[model samples]
Target: MYGVFPYNNVMATTVSRTSQKTARIDIRLTSEQRELIERAAALTGSTLTQWTAQQLMEAAQRDIETRARLALESEAFDAFQAALEEPLPDEAQQLLARSPQWA
Candidate 1:
């Protein structure tokens, strides 16, 4: 008597050794949203699979950029209205505050 395994050979698979990179993710979407994706994929002359892959890649890139933090020089930052209202150290003075040991 053999008991069934939850996952088969496919579930234990790892990334391919080829140059192409790939990832797998799980998602749940409303029927309406699913239909929208199918329609867009048809319009673009791509199979639903290819279209979904491209869209997810683009979305991941946008999310990465939007969530990243940015830094700017003091004078450049000072030109903003909020910076004008708040007192800030001079750009040159900021360099002096660093730990000498860091060098």
Candidate 2:
């Protein structure tokens, strides 16, 4: 039953102390997943906690690279700047001119 889940053992315990830093966080996971990490850790000669950290770090890096880029090309950037530079709300100014002001 335990053999049903798949894992990438190559990334299991390959930690780099030189370029890495530590942070403490609190999270919750299912017992089955926890058990799986424990088993993987044992098989890979790593602590369950360390394996989880490595997986998190790799996932975070991937997510940041994929989601966090300011990704406009040069033509789009120029167009966006031009749009911002253009005048705004001439109709709003006309409406304000027409509206009655109470003294």
C-alpha root-mean-square deviation, each candidate:
11.5, 15.6
- Per residue, candidate 1 scores C-alpha lDDT tens digits across 13-97 of 4323343556667689999998999999999999988899899889999988888857668877777757668766798578677
After superposition, the stretches of candidate 1 with alpha carbons farther than 4 Å from their true spots are: 1-22, 71-103
Q: Which residue segments of model 2 deviate by more than 4 Å?
A: 1-22, 70-103
Q: Which digits, one per residue and each the tens of the lDDT, describe model 2 over residues 61-96?
A: 999999998889999999999999887689967887
- Looking at candidate 1, the ten consecutive residues that score lowest on lDDT are 10-19
lDDT of 1 at 101: 81
State the C-alpha lDDT per candidate.
0.78, 0.79
Rate residue 90 of model 1 by lDDT.
90
Clashes of each: 0, 0
Model 1 / residue 86 / CA error / Å: 18
The numbered model that scores best in TM-score is 1
